[model samples]
Target: MENKEIILNILHEIKNGNIPVHTDYNLNLDMWADLIEYMHDRTYIADVTIYWFGDDDTYNDERVHSVNLTKVRLTTFGERFLTEEMN
Candidate 1:
């Protein structure tokens, strides 16, 4: 899915009180981290913690790595964005 769509899904899931939303999409860990950061950066979400599992030195390599999102919730702006999107 596109970034926008994925973000919307994330917001909606959070709005519905679904913590730590999961996606079945085959996106890489970096992509997920980027998306989470994107939402947080834009103030759409707050109190988010992203856990990165892997050594920093091998971050760019093909080694197995993972990212987990926690404490994520939709901010007021996120709610407004979702409402506007539905219009």
Candidate 2:
């Protein structure tokens, strides 16, 4: 998917309030390694986090790290998406 699609999807996910997804929701579903790589480069997130994936394995051929979301929030973006979808 394109960069625009990526941001839009991320925003949509955020609005949903829950990180509700199938067990197989792809983090690296497309040729979107740039986004994942960029996230991996974050300083603060890396500091407080152990591993997004359960294992300590490095980001391999798989595009995404598995996330065990403890708490998910509904951002404004997600609310809009849901509102529009419901309508």
Candidate 3:
């Protein structure tokens, strides 16, 4: 799915009280992480936890091996954005 669609779905799920919205299995982990980071950075979402490996000294890898979103919730701005997008 497109980023906009995924974002909308995520915001909608959060608005509906879904704590952690799971994406389609086919979606790339990196892309998902980027989207979550983007939203969080922009204050569109809050209370998020992201887990990753292979980017630290313990992993000794330059590339990130896995990215998991353990928690997420929509912010007021996110709700407004979702509402606007839906119209």
Identify the candidate with maximal lDDT. 1
> lDDT per residue, candidate 1, 15-84, as tens digits?
9887644455566666777777789999999987666565577665533244444566789999999899
Show the colliding residue pairs in model 1: none
The better candidate by lDDT, 1 or 2, is 1
Candidate 2 on 1-87: residue-level lDDT in tens?
A: 554455445445544543423223354423333443333343101211223333446745443444433343444444555457546
- C-alpha lDDT values of all predictions: 0.74, 0.40, 0.71
Query: Which model scores highest in TM-score?
Result: 1
Ten-residue stretch with the least lDDT total in model 3: 61-70
Q: Give the TM-score of each candidate.
A: 0.73, 0.34, 0.72
Error of 2 at 73 (Å): 3.8
TM-score for candidate 2: 0.34
lDDT measured at residue 85 in model 1 versus the true structure, 0 to 100:
90
List model 3 lDDT by residue over 1-87, tens digit each: 777888888788778876443445256666667778888998888876566665567775444345444456678898889999999
Clashes of each: 0, 4, 0
Error of 2 at 34 (Å): 6.5
